[model samples]
Target chain A: MATHEEITGSLQAFGEGYQKNKKLKIMNKDWDRVILIKAADVDSQHTLILKNGELTVTEGTPAGDPDLVVTADSETLADLFYGDITPTEPYMNGTLVIKGSEDDIVRLDFISLMIWGE
Target chain B: MKRVVSVSLGSSGRDHKVQVELLGEQFEIERLGMDGDFDRALAKLQELDGQVDAIGLGGIDVYVYAGNKKYAFKDGLKLMETVKKTPVVDGSGLKNTLERETVNYLLRETNYLNKDTRVLMVSAVDRFGMAQAFTTAGCDVTFGDLIFAAGIPYPIKTLEELEEMAGKLLPEMTKLPFHMLYPTGKKQESRDEEKAKKYAQYYRDADVIAGDFHFIKRYLPDNLNGQIIITNTTTAADVEFLRQSGASRLVTTTPVFEGRSFGTNVMEGVLVALLGKPWEEVTPEDYMDLIERLEFKPRIIDMAS
Candidate 1:
């Protein structure tokens, strides 16, 4: 299991990665959504808010409902946000689960690709 | 007379019917595109259940391969299960043997391919044999499964990596809707300019681009700089499109009939009808034998040369 500090650090790294990706910003200009990341193996959740082509990550869930929910083990979730592994890897193995539209899933995957590349 | 029908979830604009004599046996082969409607395709499969000698599931693959393991697509299997009486195929049987022969043919009879050739296979899971052939022939090959299917920019360089990736991903990925993974219906007829521009470098760098025509054309760059294309299921219009894109040559693994080269599914349907056996009973050697007996040759066209 990943500790709270590790998860927080990973989310911070993901935020920095997204902020630096101009291509992802342009691509997600019209895409606005709140994504809740739930650590299935730990008592933690992170909220990713995308609005006006910008992203901000918070430690807790949004006040309202999230458009998408990503569930994975604490380590896997941390690894994904930290770019240690691609979302495709975990998603393909059934270790990571996302509840969202296909478009949203693909867009989120694109976020990882643009940030870290394949 | 044997009758074979290919029901596709592709554009109806590409539907065609042809009569051909194969090994002293006459056969009527027809293709019906459902324009990407799964229910319509399922209904068509049900309608032609026992009516046709063999049925080909086009625009979708029932199975994709990695190494020796084959993974079934849930949607493809669902579409296939709708037909109870007809022996159904997704052209994978012929794809393995015929596409391998095509690569060998190119190496033997033409100067277009050699050990030093660089190949960009747009997607390999659906055409693993062709992917393996390019690698076996000592050519530098890039498998673009991630690039084309998932909109990722990674170019897989070796078959070992491809097999490893497929083993890890295909099990779960196959459960997703078919349309999300591939182009179907009207999606096959359109191209995304933004994607084309983004992936243009892969096209420009390759000496040869090979795979399904739809995938090849989906993100095709405006200028190819004399790259050769190896694919199948192309109409005359597709040939013109390749020419306009500045492709130097075009090669279709399947033989042309009625001015178009039908997909492997249709051709496999013909073969299945000829053999008069269950689809599961057919083998690669059987396909190769029929191919030799029919003298099936790859259609090569000099688009710009």
Candidate 2:
């Protein structure tokens, strides 16, 4: 059993790797409205929003109008970047869901393949 | 006892293409160059009325290369209309084509190849037909990097260069333009079986191995005992190596010829080999009976000619 901090660190490393590779640059350059939704927080608790590369929470705040929302478990999210599960298949199978930006979904799918080596 | 018919559609020269196989022995293949209006293509097929058991077409690569999606749906609809009774298999439906229903149809009706006999397929589109052939023949396939994403091993610019690479790398290969590997090593002993072992996991179960020329080279087991089919490729040497490598047969189409897909060639070639007839001489009658026996009646005519 790995610690949550360890898993988050791994995901952050992968995110940095993807950034270094320019595989998954967030389109439209608006990081303030981007949110990562964990599966455990389906009720909208623990929403991690990135603003100027800083993290904050809109916990219990009326589910704000974010530009993009990525929803998946931490493990699945980690594996998404690692290329183990196909994003398209997962999306189709309901393992992952993205809202607020179809373009972001496309970009995510393309970048996921580049980052994950699929 | 269903029959099998395979068809392909894509641009004549580009790499993107599709192949579809239907269960039965007979086939009705209607091919048109990527040129001409869809109406004209429909006219050509109308002439073959009641003659085809299945229909395949080509040209997606040209569209992708040119970034034009025009006429694609029209072409598909036109072909669909022509082969009203035939099952009109095309490359896009690979997943649906390879179901248990289809495989059982292929095995029960045909006196299929059993790995020892060499069968050749030309211009197989993508990896679908090759996968089906793998299930039918029970032998391993190898190829070069053009099919896989891994990159070409040898530097080749011309067909002759490819052939040279094939001879120098794989002397025992009997199939050319295989989607497997272009040998960088001469002796099978020098060839890296570990690499083969590592890559085999990706396609150990796949009937067809898809990769660039190098991907084929990477995945091929050192001990191969069957036939090979070459799809879209440019290297002549790879073809030469395949011929040397105990490949029981080799199938190829004219270079850059798209409308008349290599997949159709693969299907017709295998069927000819199975029926023991010269490939060119094999006729629609041979396939028609298979379709009739299989009961894979074509869809009712959706539109008038």
Candidate 3:
């Protein structure tokens, strides 16, 4: 079992990596939006704001017009950034939930694509 | 670390050996392609049986799924019967599991498939898992199985439309020897570049292009800007080709390792070895579990700026 802070740190690192990735940045040019992610059981939350081809992560779920709202477990969310999980089967099987525009979902997964190269 | 080897009927040029790290473990993956020589493929399978950690038959499927029933191919079944000491599975096992996950990954998590998305599958039968996933995801699905695989040269709009043809088509086709129906192994290595160009219209019309990599590569035009390809199997060189040709994104259902995404059977053999299960004991669900645990996403090339 991972602590909420540990998962949050992983998310922060993911944002930093996504910001520094040139190939992923090229894919994310049309993907500027704010994304809210909440872990289902731990009450850990983070906001990923994407603009000007850069991604910044803020602690807690700040109230704003987010482009996407992603909800999953602390493990799943953390594992996702760690490059060991794909959200597709989880999303299809009802383990992961997303409330956002279709394009935003694509942007979020594109980050995973960059990390795992898949 | 685990060792997995495949006996492939495809050409020798495609034979490869590589190491990959997955599921918190290391794997040495080796494949021997016989260049469309069934005698050699079986002989190699015979020699390697019980020697390697796991065995796989590549470049062809063992079974076809329609509804809930599965139809097994004769050559594949015979080969499976020969391997007594080691577990062996045709590529179908991983195709049934990974291809579906890969397509759904793109459809639900990516903007590639929505109501308005136009999808063209070069040979849906070659990757039926992907074809069904796209339809289930509610995209307007097109099946080129008859056109590409059966040589009918015309695309059908729905699974229902293709199902109508499968009953008459597969029974007779499956009865014949495997290679007679379609080029397998090394036979696939060569292409009729001009003939391949005829299907350019299908490639041009779709926003999302999905299918078996061989079929996709056969018909894909040189220009594919903004097009999203969802398929299984790809080489690193293949990726460079798509990138240079202006493809926006390339999504290979199998995960990339050592500069190439592998055949479905090879991935399945890895799972069987990891789970310590006999070839027959491992169900498709088990295959799905290994993929889920590994968190292996489809290899993607997102050169779309």
Candidate 4:
């Protein structure tokens, strides 16, 4: 029986792995800056840089400019990552809040599918 | 004209609006404030005891005090024994109020039993809501839950999808009702087939079944094999299929529609279908009337989430 705590733990661990593999998908010359995704419950923020074939996620705010920022409630965020809720619906429903250009949002979606493999 | 009356203090779950809509019109509802006292709540209800049909002993708290040292420490089973004559039902407040409209529709409309009148519950997600609806509408209740570790997900779009998928996976007669066991691999496919096979076997043996979707037909061989699959659906196609299958009962699936979903209106119609008199008795006009009468902005409490 996986308790709620266990679910949160697994999500955190998966997020770490996701950070490492993100850059491999963003080889296009135009995509070089960082993307920020802040889930509600984790307390701290995250900075993911996808420039080269390798990806990197650090604990604090990004030193360089961030290309995009996405924020949402904990439940919605977890469901989005887990495929329970699709990305576009949440934004339309206001469950997820996005702050970035249209290009950045599309690129973020591509990165999400690449990281989560869906 | 009044049979056994069942009422609850407010509604429960996210579908309070639907439950309230269904319950408000047919039955006399006693609203209990979040800060209200239990004894006072019961006394207010007792005022309508003999005047109406029957006194439904709303929520469990009405009988047993929640933080009261005497009842909390001691067993409160005696309370039910004391109030046996009023035909008291253990109704839920949260779900009834939250999903009020749909739940009210189901309670007032759906037929739980046929000629045999054996009211067996298929899913336990909102057993309190089901109990409130059926018992109020006049039916004896038998309820159970599917034992699982991962936990059954809530408020799917339809039960037919549930039945179709579960039936396809474990089609063997031996594992007739897949919902009896823990349904694994909800959002995605299960990485391990061995685990899935083990649970399917467990479902094969279990007698009672419960879930949001339907796959019970795959488990049962014949129509008269004493199999009942109770599921909630929002799709018109599934609704038509359920009608065609001659299912024992089909409750509408009401998701907490804080925002708009395409299926909410259809789900509302399904609730009305189940809660109103008989399936054959109520018409499409009746459902539309109920929806029109019950429409209201859902109450959004900050702490509720």
Candidate 5:
């Protein structure tokens, strides 16, 4: 029910909130990873970049090898931002799937938990 | 309009209504919290049994699931047998389905707590769904159910310790009345400052504190400057309380309405009423479908406290 731009904008806003947070937790400064979220329904892409302990959301690839790639429908991605559905069920059922190394998958998922706090 | 009511023995003497409109059909959700008075709450349930469209059993869960196992409470079963009316669900069924989704949502969507996160779970036995999710996420989870819930000190180091304690505690927990577990009000906590002060260290030591709001609130330090709290069932005043205590970020597992996040039983009642299906006939898939369509996402409040 949401557009790719809307999802991108929402993540950006969430990143801004994290930055403003004085006592919030962030991925350690030493760790940085670029994640590509592919919305197969709309055939659009948004990148979530975490570098130097700060997070940013931008449209399309940001000139870096993404450590993780998540593919799912637009509604599923929208619901993820809205804090409802988890990628596990979709990933398990093959409605939504992810491509990444074991460490990236685990670490990125942990980061996702931190961002949304579901 | 469909009418749904919740009966609870551990409501701590609170009662109210929550309204949710699904597909343009209005639903009235009423919660009757009898504090420690189970008899009164049971009486209320009997009065509304067949009259109401659905009934929600609050406070104590009917079944607690852990890994591939489930343990049902004897007292909860008795209440169900007596009701014998319209669909009566404890919300545990939906909780089992939704809480896992919630954990996975956090795991794959947000960057909240990591494996190194020190989580102090007040009563993992009561909400096994959360317990399993936290452990699966690889957090350094500590179970404080014995100390926090039962007012007995039992330091839990591993998930094994938690399982052992849950096996023993969950049974006896439902037998006793609510007052034995929790004091009546915040002021009552002053009666045991020594105990409260001791718990402040646990609150201070943990990076990411996770548990029920009541348990966390019972032991919160005067300040929580950089703490991230993961809990449910909170009121607006509780939010102010956390803000005053310096909670850096707060997220309730359930949606906050009016000034509080409601009990799962209330949410389940809403779902049952909306589905308009017999409780026994509904499945996890049905709940998931209704949840996604409803998009009843948990609330994330912006705190200034």
Candidate 6:
């Protein structure tokens, strides 16, 4: 399990990383969506709002429906946002589960790739 | 006379039709690219059902093997399920046998490959036999399945590691849409320079680059420095691109017809047509036997002056 502050800090850092990545901004200019990240182990949830080529992270559930939902252990979620591990690693191992359309999932993966080069 | 049609999700620009005599049989071979439209591909398969002698599913793999475990792709399986009468194949049947022989042929007939060669296989799960052949030949092989397919930087160095990774990843990954796993439609026609530059070291460090042409071309660096590329489904334009990229040689496992090598799916469809049996009943030994009788030789090009 992870502390609430740690999870929120990691999510904020992930948003900051995306904000600073020019290539990711350009690539995702037209991709606007609300993504819900649920830490299964910690029973915590966070919302990632992407609109107009910008990303913002907020703790807790979103006010409306989310276009995508990513479910993973608290540690895995923290590590993913902290850039310690890639989503591919956990996703491949069945530790991370994402529910969304294929296009949105690929775009999210590409965002991670752009933010943390291969 | 028999006819075989390959309904593909690739770019329409690469569609081709040819008439060839094989093993004393006259056959009309055609490849129709659907530009990544799944509905269109399904409709095409329905239209061709019971009409063609055999159908080949292109641009998507119905199954990929790792070790002895085989995983099925959801989209590929859906495309296959549309047909009722004609046999359909996604090329996995021939990739295992034909690609292994191609490696052995190169070892026996050409100087391009040797024990000292450093090989980079872009995606091994799709062609496990070729990967095993390189390892069996005692060549240093780096399987780039994770690196190329998932944008992960990890390079699997042995068949065991690849199999282990496959066991963990492939089950869930196969359920995703085919395009998420592969490049299709017009996406095949372009390369991402940023990705190419980021992963160029893997290409520059290898003596031989092998695997799917699209995966190889997706991140192909501008300069290969005389590296040899071993793949199939190369059009004349792909050959010219390789030559300009400084590749020394090109080896296609399938024989080239009308200036391009047909995909393993097309070749496998041809084999199925000649075998005159259901695809499930046909075995690897059958494919090898026909290959030996036909004296099928790989199409090798010397790109370096």
Q: Write the per-residue lDDT of candidate 1 for residues B1-305, one digit (tens) a residue.
A: 88999999999999999999999999999999999999999898998998989999999999999999999999999998898999999999899999999999999999989996999999998999999889999999999997888766678899987887677567666767788878899989999687899899999999999998999988998888989999999999999999999998999999999899999999999999998888889989899899999999998999856
> What DockQ does candidate 2 score?
0.02
lDDT (C-alpha) at residue B248 in model 2: 35
| Docking model 6 quality class | incorrect
- Pairs with steric clashes in candidate 6: none
> Which ten residues in a row are the worst by lDDT in model 3 chain B?
B167-176
**C-alpha lDDT of residue B264 in model 1:** 97
What TM-score, to 2 decimals, does candidate 3 have? Answer: 0.68
Better of 2 and 5 by TM-score: 5
lDDT of 2 by residue, B1-305 (tens): 22233222322222233333435333333343434234554565565444543344432211100011111232344455575543443333321232222334334543433463332211122333343444355533332222222221211223333333333222211111111122221221133465556444333333333322333543455434443333333234444554454443333322222332234333333344345543335455665454344444211111111
lDDT of 3 by residue, B142-204 (tens): 777755664434578878756655553554355446664556765476664654676677788
lDDT, model 6, position A5: 77
How far in Å is the alpha carbon of B177 misplaced in model 1? 0.2
Q: What RMSD does each model have against the real structure?
A: 6.1, 17.9, 21.7, 19.8, 21.0, 8.0
Quality class of the docking in candidate 5, CAPRI style: incorrect
TM-score against truth, every candidate: 0.81, 0.30, 0.68, 0.25, 0.65, 0.79
lDDT of 1 by residue, A1-118 (tens): 9977788899999999999877567657667899999999789988999997899989888999999999999999889889888887688678999999775787687677567653
Best prediction by TM-score: 1
List iRMS (one decimal) for every candidate.
Answer: 6.9, 15.5, 17.1, 18.6, 15.6, 9.1
Ranking by lDDT: 1, 6, 3, 5, 4, 2
Instruction: Flag clash pairs in model 3.
Output: A118-B299, B10-B185, B10-B186, B11-B35, B11-B185, B11-B186
lDDT of 2 at B112: 35
